[model samples]
Target: MLAQTNLPQVAHGAPYLSVVVPIYNEEESIPHLYTRLQEALDELAKPYEVLAIDDGSRDQSFHLLRELAQQDGRWRVVRFRRNFGQTAGFAAGFARARGEWVVTIDADLQNDPRDIRMLLAKAEEGFDVVSGWRAKRQDPFLNRRLPSQLANGLISWATGVRLHDYGCSLKVYRAAVVKQIELYGELHRFIPAIASWQGVEVAELPVNHEARKYGTSKYGIGRTTRVVLDLITVRFLLSYSTRPMQVFGAVGLLFSGLGGALLAYLAYIRLFMGSPLADRPLLLLAVLLVVLGVQLLGMGLLGELVTRVYYEGRQRPIYVVREELNIE
Candidate 1:
């Protein structure tokens, strides 16, 4: 038996944990969803709910889920009007979550729901996020498994998360960490990188991986290409990454200053010794530097302008309400 406590009326009320399952085209898997979820949460000593966001599956997945939700209060389903991608589903689930901790898993059953206890155990140890590592994944190596392994390895090197399986579908995060990060595009796969970027402590634990019993794997080689591009973007956005002037302006200034100094030397030479300015390679370098410097300076100014404009337009609120949970 489960009971939900209502707090003051606000955007979010705190619960022990919220499981965000992004479902798509998993008609065959819906039958077993509630059973596995109940099994996992049974071991946990806290109240929790399953926030299953259906990404507009054209099958009986959503309809079945709605029936399941009606049967049990702990199980809730959010249906999207159209087929937004997995990231979008996860994003919507996270946005609608009302728990102190958030656990995310794929609906295809490749990830064991029972291992959520392992992740939650790690989270209890005070880490901001705990990701599952499929050390001995049961999936075949030739097609889906090898590509995922390679991508996880490359992503680890690029972002320094260093988990055996960054692409693993199962992960648990503190609610504060989940709420703080902005997830869009395919960036849901790179949650640890973003959390680390925001100074959240992240760790990984080896968990049991099961072969899928139902439904098809939604991922393909296309996801690999998207991940590569998104990795570059994530690294850049670690700071004023989108702001171009910070990098370009510094380079431009250094080069331009050198060019100006060289030109000054050329002027001295032309004035005193009557050397032809066009004859010297140093003069040409100076001219180039000056031009580069101007470009750099312009870039810096432009970046600053863009940044200011963005903040001004956003009208971001300065104050936020944070609720504490499960902490002594």
Candidate 2:
């Protein structure tokens, strides 16, 4: 479970909607983004709080965010010491969110704040997570759209949680659903897949997209490699996080069985069929396979021990950082 902090509440009691925005170097877009969010959410007529996460922005984004928060009681700001990436920014927001429904969006103004109503309506139909899909994405097809499509397909195939746009930062989740899952690394992109371990209902909706009005895109082919690598870790956590020995032991047994069969055949030929016992590469291969099998089996046993400590002991955490500035 995520640890929630004591955050200020709106005048109209607790907010039903908590919008999380991750701010990078979006100094130019912050003011307009805040205005749009305020307008759209006030029209919804529900008590809402906007959680603007300042992810070590080196520009005037943090100053603008603080100024806005001081002006609007419903707006809150959290600033990190240095840029820890978007995933960490979202994690920090999730840690402090106190609404029934939590929403995540980018601060580049590309994600339309008006689309929040659509996602919330979809969630009202008993879905735990409502992911926004950019069906008509407004980006370069070769550089952005094509790679995102491929990655979405790969992630869906690997994790069995199909969605057209995993890269879309505009997504909605029930507080119950998101608070239960701990996010670290770049696994924020796989929230639906991660939450599926508990049988949560996830929905996808087409949301309006716009070209970036300010700042360069923080994403590129560089982030694609990191997402793919993190997928491997996500797959492991979903399948073997609790009992890793099952996978490792299965592989170990296969190698050991193959090696044993080869050694047995060699022994038979040497003893009964009069085959030469020396100077054959098969002998060395068999010995190496046997040794490798033993090592793998040992690794499986060690993995089991670590899993126990990870679950039972809970000795290590996923993130730790110190900062000169920490505020909310």
Q: Report, for every candidate in turn, its global Cα lDDT versus the true structure.
A: 0.78, 0.84
Candidate 1 residue lDDT tens string, 1-328: 2222332222134568889998888888877776788777867867787887778789888777766665666666777777778777777667768888899998888788999988898988999989998899887787767888888888888887777887787999888787777677788888888888668888889988888889877877767788888988777666555576877787988998899899889999899999898777887789988998998889788888887786568543221212111211
Clashing pairs in 2: none
What is the Cα-based TM-score of model 2?
Answer: 0.92
lDDT of 1 at 84: 71
Which parts of model 2 are misplaced by more than 4 Å? 1-12, 313-328
Candidate 2, RMSD to the unseen true structure: 4.8
* Per-residue lDDT of model 2, residues 7-96, tens digit only: 433345678998989888988888789778878888888888888888888988887877676566677778787788888888877877
